[model samples]
Target chain A: MSKVMVVTSGKGGVGKTTSCASLGAALAQAGRNVVVVDFDVGLRNLDLVMGAERRVVFDLVNVVQGDAKLPQALIRDKRIDTLSLLPASQTRDKDALTEEGVGRVIDELREKFDWIVCDSPAGIDKGATLAMRFADLAVVVANPEVSSVRDSDRIIGLLDSKTRRAESGEAMEKHLLLTRLDAARAARGEMMKVEDVLEVLAIPLLGTVAESPDVLTASNLGCPITLHSPTSPAARAYTAAARKLLGETVTVTPAREKRGFMSLLFGKKAVLQ
Target chain B: MSILNFFSRNRSAPVARERLQLLLAHERTLAGKSDLVALLQREVLGVIARHIAIDPDKVIVKLDETGHVSTLEIDIEVPEGALARG
Candidate 1:
């Protein structure tokens, strides 16, 4: 059966878009047909992150409103054969996503794709709710900070109460992807450790993405981090998370500190004198 | 242990977790209280309407909790002499 998962965070700037792009690419690289849909209507960035910015002709709004067909709006990735992107409109507001319209679009996608990853917008408003309304599982992205964790807690609450599965009294599966973790700072007690975050949120840990400049570089280059720098710590963590999501019994490991040139360039302390 | 606790005062996760626990508990209690109040309001309005004339919209039900005890406050507005006429 096809599954719809939402990459969401209650607060903005916590890497939901990045997680969606990376996880989508990783799943497609594993030979599954995956489409990452951008639900952040006005501030559409999934196409840019997926390096398909110039190729967007018809967006999700067009598909939902029946102005364009699904194949016409779906942007197939040039790098990965199985990956696609359903871009959101940059001009329309959240109200453009009507319940019936979104339902139709999602149903069409469900029939065509193996997995649908919805990149939810920040906040607990109509846009966020609509993004997660039909989700079977949720990847709740959070940073290792108090505000981020608290916001994730709120998103977890919404996932339990506001989803179709929740309304039907079925449990909605949720996994926590902790991003932007600084191991050095966490050791110094400046940030929350992975265990602490899991304890506070009370959810299963998907994986931890270490703080890396490669992430910013990849995004700036308009490519998913996994495709851009497949060997980086962040990319590896995302790949492992994808593998775990596929029900593979892999050991969950913490993100490693970068070595070689990466450590020299972005490392906290100099590796050399 | 005291010194360690003092140094850990700036740790933000514990504070956030504590605050969320309180807020979520309060919100849940308030939700249940509101549902109960709605039921009570409907029943009380039905009984009062049989004996007297009052504005149904003007009835108010409030729940206040202190420690383990809770106080239920109700106020219903009736026109002057409506009760006497009943």
Candidate 2:
């Protein structure tokens, strides 16, 4: 059966687009037909993250407005054959996205793909609500911080009350994707621990991506980290998350802290090594 | 700064977590009813003021929830001997 997932966070810049791209690529690499739809409307960035910005001839607005068809707007990823992207229009605002039109697009997408990943816009607005309207599952992305966790809680409230599944009295499965976690900082009491975030959000954890330069490198290359640097810490975390999403029981490991030369020489654990 | 203050400042995560818990609890209780809460506070204060000399600024009306149960909490401060005047 096909599943629709929304990658969202009420707070902005918490790696929603990054999670959407990486998870979509990871699932496609696992041989699942995945289409990631960007729902950010005027502030579209998913196409750039997927490295298909130049190929965006028609966008989601075009399809919803009936100016173009679904197939015509979907940009197939050049590297991943099973992966495709439906970019949002930068020229149109969120008001251009009508609920009825978005519902029609999502219904058509359900018949064609194994997984439909929607990259929701930030904030609780029409765009965000529409993105999650047809979702069976939600990946609430957040950083291990006060603002991010608090905003994620608000998003969770909306996910439980505003979505179509919620309105129909069906439970919407929610998972927390805690990204940009610096293990060393978290240990030093500078950032929230994984357990603390989970306790507050009260959702099952999907996975945690470490704070690493590799993420920026992948974004710069316009390729999903899973494909750009498969062995990198962030990529491994995302791949494990994708596996868990597919109902596989995979043990999630914390992102390894990069040891500096001084720590490597003088750290107590280093002596044993 | 004193050493104790320095140590207290080091653990910011716990402080953030505690604040978020309180904030989320307050926000969740008032979700979709902030306007109603404000109106209720004003109307309840009005009725109370008609019978007692109370400071409107000091009065607080809020909804607090523990687990599944929600309670409407009202705290009013009246000056001493105001009951005799009323």
Candidate 3:
């Protein structure tokens, strides 16, 4: 059976798109059929993250509006055979995602893919709600900041109240993917520790992606970090997170601090913005 | 001393954590107040009111989340001796 997982954060710039791409790529590399759907509408970033931007001819809006078929709009990842991308329309508004249309598309996708990872837009709006309406589980992407944690808490409440599973009296499994963690800063009390965030949000920890220049470099190179720099701390953390998502018994830990020698060599601080 | 401890004394993280806890509790209570209030009133408060002379409308249900456990408080006012009779 296909599992629909929504990678969402109520706040923007918290790495929701990055998590979707990395997890989707990681799962595909592990031989799972995964499709990462971009629901950011006007500001589509998942395609850019997955390096499938140039190949996107028809997008989610086109498929939903009946202008194109599902297979025609799906972009198969060139590097990962089992991975695909359903890019959102940069030209269309969030209103283009109709409830019935999204339902039909998700139902059709459930038949063909083992995982449907929906990348939701920021804030609790039609786009975000529509992205999460049919989810079987949620990966709430959060940063180690107050605003991000608070916003993710709001998203968690929505996952409990606004989802189809919630309405149908089914439990919506939610895990917190804490991103942009700076271990040195966290140790210095400059950033909220993973335990503090888990306490505040009260959600199960998925994985922690440390503050790393590898993320920026990978984004600039238009590849998932796990594929671009497989040995990097961020990549390893994401892979572990993917394993945990598959019910593997992997011990969860905060991302390692790699700022001293690595920063001196790279000459750029891997700080969260 | 390790240079990593340079910012150890900064108070921003604790401040942010405190504010986030307060805000999350307030937000959760606000979102769940109505439905939870109705349900509790119909089931719990009704039974309590039967044994005591109490005001159902004034019952307060505040959800305070500390760490992983959320504490729910139901404050209902009852006249003196109302509980003593039952």
Candidate 4:
């Protein structure tokens, strides 16, 4: 059966766009037909991140509104044969996305692709709720912080009520993607610790991404980190996260210096002399 | 609370969790205490008016984030004889 996973968070700038690009690329690299759908309408950032911005002629709204056919809206990646992108409309109002319209497109995608991944916009507004509506699974993107965790908790509540499985009162398969993690700062008591976020969210941890400028470099160049800097720590974490999504028994590498909560406090590496 | 406190408390160990703590809440409040100031104003005035008629416009509840610790201030301009009745 095909899986439709929505990459969502109650907050933005948490690397949902980055994760969508990397996981889509990873699955395609593994030879599965995967299409990453950008549901962040008007902003429409996924295309630029995927390096397909200049190539988009039609978008999800076009397919839904019948302005263009599905194939016309789909853009294949030049680097990866198996990965594709269903870009969002830059000019279309977010209101253009109707429940029935999105349902039609999602149904079409599920039949043709092994995985249909939706990248949800931030907040608990209509945009976010719609993105997760058809999702069989959800990747809740959260930064290791209190506000993001609280927002994620709100989203978890929404997921339990706003989704197809949720309407039927079935549990929505959800996982947490903690990004921008800085081990050094975390050691110095400057950031939220991973275990803390996990406890509050209460969802299974998919993986953790260490803070890396490589993510910025890739997004700037319109490439997924997995494709832009595949060897970086962040990209490797994403790959591992993807494997975990596939139900593979994998061990997530713990961040350095995070051996114990109190032990991390004094290990601060004062800048190199 | 600070980002460090956010992580420390959540991890059940006082580890620094600054990235998410500072960044996320900063994003949520969008402008920090400036936003909370508005929310606190409504609640504080509503509660205080039970005994006195203080000008709601002049009442200010704010978080002073200077110093190593964060402090909250509720400055009220009670209409001269407003507090005399209490």
Task: Report lDDT (Cα) of residue A250, candidate 1.
Answer: 68
Question: TM-score for every candidate vs. truth?
Answer: 0.80, 0.84, 0.80, 0.74
lDDT of 3 by residue, A1-273 (tens): 899999999999999998899999998888899999999999999999888889999999999999999999999999989999999999989999899999999999999999999999998999999999999999999999988888898899999999999999999999989888877666556788888898898888888888789999999998999899999989998999999888899887558775565335433332331
Interface RMSD of 3: 3.4
Off by over 4 Å in 4: A255-265, A268-273, B1-86
RMSD of 4: 9.4
Question: What is candidate 2's local distance difference test score?
Answer: 0.89
TM-score (chain A) of candidate 3? 0.94
Give the per-prediction TM-score of chain B: 0.64, 0.63, 0.53, 0.56
Top candidate when judged by lDDT against the true structure:
2
| Candidate ranking (lDDT, best to worst) | 2, 3, 1, 4
TM-score of 4: 0.74
Residue lDDT tens for model 2, A39-146: 999999999999999999999999999999999999999999999999999999999999999999999998999999999999999999999998999999999889
**Could you tell me the TM-score of chain A in candidate 4?**
0.93
Runs with alpha carbons beyond 4 Å of true place in candidate 1? A257-273, B1-86
Report lDDT (CA) for all predictions. 0.86, 0.89, 0.87, 0.81
DockQ, prediction 3: 0.34
- CAPRI-wise, candidate 1 is incorrect
